[model samples]
Each structure stands twice: as C-alpha cells, then as structure tokens.
Target chain A: MTPHLSITDQPVDVASALAAVQTDAAGAVNAFIGTVRNQSGGRPVRRLHYESYDSMALTQLGHVVAQAYEKWPMLQEVAVVHRKGTLELGDVAVVVAVATPHRAESFAACQFIIDTLKQVVTIWKREEYEDGTEWVAAHP
Target chain B: MSLKVALFGITRDIVGTSVIELPAPAPATVGELLAEMRKQYPALGELRSCAVAVNNEYATHDHPLRTTDEIALIPPVAGG
Candidate 1:
C-alpha cells in the first residue's frame, strides 16, 4: 500500500508535495505546516529536539489517517510528515495535507489531523534555551 | 509487584530510558503515577506541561492505571 503517513526528522518539501497532488481530480487541497517557535512560556528558545518511539509513533500516525477517512468519507488522500531530532527556531516540525473533492472537507480533515496530533500522537519536543533546556509537554 | 511505564520525550531523556517499572501496587490514577514517577526520577519533577495518554488516547489525569495497561508520556510536539 502507498503509505499516506510518514514521520521523519528531515525538512519538509511543501512545493514538491503540492506538485504531486492530483489537482485535476482533487478539487481542493488543504495543507498545514507546523514550525518551531521563538519562545515557549515566554522564555526565549535557542533550539528544539524531538523524539519518539519510532514503531509506535508510526502506528499512531496511521491511526490518524484512519480516523480522518472514517469521519470524512469524501477525503481522498492524506500526507503527514513529522520531523525528529534537533531543530532550530523557525524550522518545520510537522506537515499535514489532505485532498478532497470539496474545500470544506479538506480543511476539516487537515485541522482534525493537526489538532488531534497534538493531543494523541506520541511525539515529544524539548526546548533548548540559552540558559537551559526543557521539554515541552503540550501544544501551545 | 511491578508495572512497566513507558516514558517518552523529556521524561525518557531525563530518566534516560523508554520504559520504567514501578514497585508493586502501582498508582491508581495517571496523575498519581506521575507523582510517583517524580518521586523516583528527580528529572520528572521539572516537567509542568507534560501530557499522559492511556494506550493511544489523550487521557485525563483521573484516568485509571492497571498493571496490564499501556501508558505513554507525550511531551510537546514540534512537527510541521
């Protein structure tokens, strides 16, 4: 099967992804990108490190697509990319793309994937500050 | 008796492992389990915004824990 979900540490290529989408068939394409921020809890961030239990993490990512398909029958395809390892501020951390016949369904599915990913997916990030480093626990 | 608890992200890195086993009579709730972990692993005490999931779902602090249940510690996500 063509895997619709992926988890990686490398940078994301949004244009290539957009180029691959079958725009002819997909009337709408909605994509969401997550990037590292400059601060967390008002503290300045130098960099961030992300880690996960690879196998289990992939399993949970697959579940997100399954849930999306179940909830939005019209959804055609989904592409998910998650980065791991050390990342500096302003780096891309995660990307979610959904294609459907309509814009509304694509938007809904993309939002659900990202919002729920924060709450469900087993990925963790640590914020490295100038003074020290701390792991972030929730999406803010 | 002991139960295995999987810590991830900051928790694992701080304690330095993916799985941790607690002494018998594991805490009844997820929150209590976290408290116990803090007492055992000093680094866990530094986390104030970590999230807990029972199996794969984002569970509440009141979520019950069992010897056989799968528990995961999810730190913040920065994926885009």
Candidate 2:
C-alpha cells in the first residue's frame, strides 16, 4: 500500500501526493489542493496558523482513507496530506489524491476523503489578520 | 489520581497550556474529565462543539479514561 496519509508543517507537495497515488492499474487520477485564501468572511487574512494533535490526526486520516475505500471499492490508491503551522496566502495547505479505474470513482473518493477529514480530524486553523487572530470555526 | 490531557487549538489558548494535568478520580469517564476541564477553564464552554479522543480514536462521553490513556481535546476542526 502507498503512503496515503500524512500531516506536516512544511508546504504540501501536490506533485508528490499525486505521484504516491499513481498506479499501473489506475486509468484515472484525481487530486484536490486546498490553499490559504486571501480572505475569509470579508476579513483580509494575513496568514493562517494550523495545529493538530499529530498522532490523533494521523489516525483519523487513516480512518478517512479506509472510509473512502469502503465507499468506493474501485479506488486503487489514495493520498491525503495536510500542512500545519503558519502559511501565507496562496500556500498549499492540503492535497488529496485518488486513483481508480475510472474518473468518476477517483473524483468521488478524493472528495469524500477531504470532506470526511475536515469533519473527523483533530486539526484546526487560526486565521490571522492585521487586527487580530481567531481560531476558525471555534465559536458557537 | 492525576490524568494528563493533551490540548490543541483554541482549547490550548483558553487553558494557556498544551498539556493539562487534572486531579481526576480513578475510573473516570470522558464526560467526567470534560466536566472537570470546564470547571477549571470555563472558557472552554464557549466552543460550539468538541470531541474527546482517547488513545487516538474518538471516544464517547461515557468512555472510561485510564491514567495512561492518551487523551486529546478536539475542537471544531476547519482543516481541508
């Protein structure tokens, strides 16, 4: 099995993530890259600081991969890489890649991996603006 | 007995520490630990929702916590 899950403080490498999920049997590969937007909810963001419970996040990431496989049995491989720590605008923060025998399944699996990861993983991001900083999705 | 709970994100900021040591009774459930945490740091109550992870997996409120269990406070996640 390919290395399908990771959490890093460095920049997320989209190419490597796609490469990891590439296989000879796969006829289609889909990749999703999430970058730091310049603004959020009308406030200009200076940067983003991401944090995670490393071990727990990794374990949850593995579960996400397993879920993708369970949902799309045709998926040949999957890679999910989430970047932590400070990131400037336009920096790649996450990459999800999936390969399968067909395009539709690969795309669906990739989407499911990212969507499930955001819900279940123990990772958070703090949006820093010129005036102040706040943890995203923290308040009720 | 004392149990050390790992804190992250807003919980860490509210508690002002990455790891917190709480005086928990033996055979404590995750709900009990969270109650103690909220009592100590009431600011945690402001969160919309949070999950408790025991030994790297999401734990139910009634899940029993051992002294050696790796406990983590998972706040509302926003990672993509």
Candidate 3:
C-alpha cells in the first residue's frame, strides 16, 4: 500500500485520516494532536496565530515520513497535518498519526514524526494577549 | 554582487518577508557578512541564536563567503 503521509493547513479530520489509513494488515494506529492553549508562562493568551512556508513545510513533513518508513520497514501508512491561521484555546494545531502491523512500530513512528516536525519544519506561532504579544519558539 | 539569503521565523516577520538579495563585499567571511547584515537589518541583532548557513549548509562564524553563493541566517529551529 502507498504511504499516506500528508501535511495540511486545513482543520485536520482525525476520523477521515483514521479511515483512510486503516488496513487489515495494520494492527495499531498511534496518533498525537497539539492544541492551542490559553496561557504561556504567566501571560494570559487571548488567541494564537500560526504561519508556515506551506510548500516547504509539507516537503519537510514528507521527509520525516520517509525516514520513519526506512527505520521501520513494517510501517504501513502515515499522516502529519498542521493548521495555519488564527487558533484559540483547545484548538488542535498539529496532528501526527502512524499505522503499522504492530503496536511498537506505530508508537515509535508517531513519536518520530512529531519530534522531526518540531525540529525541522519551518512553522511559526504568535501569541496574543490582552496586555501584550509575543512569538513563542516552536522548539528550544 | 548580490547575495541571496533565507530568513525564517521572527526574522521573516520583522522584515515582513523572506528571501532577500543584498549586495555583498568582496570575499568576506560569514562573520563579516553577518556584521554587515546586522547593520542593514537591525532587527536581526535582537535574536539570541541566529544560525548561519552557506549554500543551505550550516557553517561557523568564520566561514568564508562567495559572491556567487547563497547565504542564509536562520533563527533556531523550533517546531514541536
């Protein structure tokens, strides 16, 4: 089967992705979703804005999937989605899902995807507060 | 000659865009070029860790730069 990896700016539908990637041969599906929060440190955030170099970000996401496939030859499918634009508290910003014939491969691949995405992809987030504003580093 | 550079994250936001081409001095080190860039773009100096990359590969401060090559100052990688 084809590798079902994707990086999207639209609101990701977990249901749809789960259906599309489910296979009889694959027994486990691991997933992760990053959500917008209402606060950062001591500041109370009113809203959050996310932006990215969309085409380049997707290309980097694809590279992460390729690396996962290489490391876990049993991996069946993968998908990584990221939201771009204004987001509020509790809104999902990123979703990474992986499926494999066993639980360990799916778990490891999903973690790898999120870690790689955070490390390499070109995405930015701006936090807005009532008193001020700031841009949070997507990583350390 | 023109030396193109890739800007990311806060650098892109403060500059209001990315992928800029600026004039380069003749045969300068990456450190020298960055000093010139910081002068032209004062906002970049505010960043704590602006990494230097030559031709898409990361390099140290003293790496020599060529007029015909691409140079980019990338802020720290923050994605997760």
lDDT of 1 at A64: 73
lDDT of 1 by residue, A1-140 (tens): 13366677678777655555545668998989888889887888998888866666777788877888899987777788888888887888887888889999988999998888776577777788999976565423
Candidate 1: where is the Cα deviation over 4 Å? A1-3, A19-23, A138-140, B1-5, B21-39, B42-80
User: For residues A91-120, what per-residue lDDT tens digits would candidate 3 score against the true structure?
Assistant: 888877778998988888899889888876
Residue-level lDDT of model 3, residues B21-79, one tens digit each, is 76644437778767877887887787766767675555788898777766666675555
Could you tell me which residue pairs clash in candidate 1? A9-A84, A34-B80, A93-B79, A93-B80, A94-B79, A94-B80, A95-B80, A136-B76
Q: Candidate 2, residues A1-140: lDDT per residue as tens digits?
A: 54478889888889998889889999999998999999999999999999988888898898888877788878898888899999999999999998999998987888888888889888899999999999999997
- Residue B76 in candidate 3, Cα distance off native in Å: 2.8
Tens digit per residue, CA lDDT, model 2, B1-80: 88888889999999999998876454399998788788888989889987888999999999998888998898899888
C-alpha-based local distance difference test score of model 2: 0.88
What is the Å distance of residue B19 in model 3 from its true position?
Answer: 4.4
Worst 10 residues of 1 chain B by lDDT: B71-80
* Residue A60 miss distance in model 2 (angstroms): 0.4
Error of 1 at A46 (Å): 1.8
Q: Point to the candidate with the largest TM-score.
A: 2
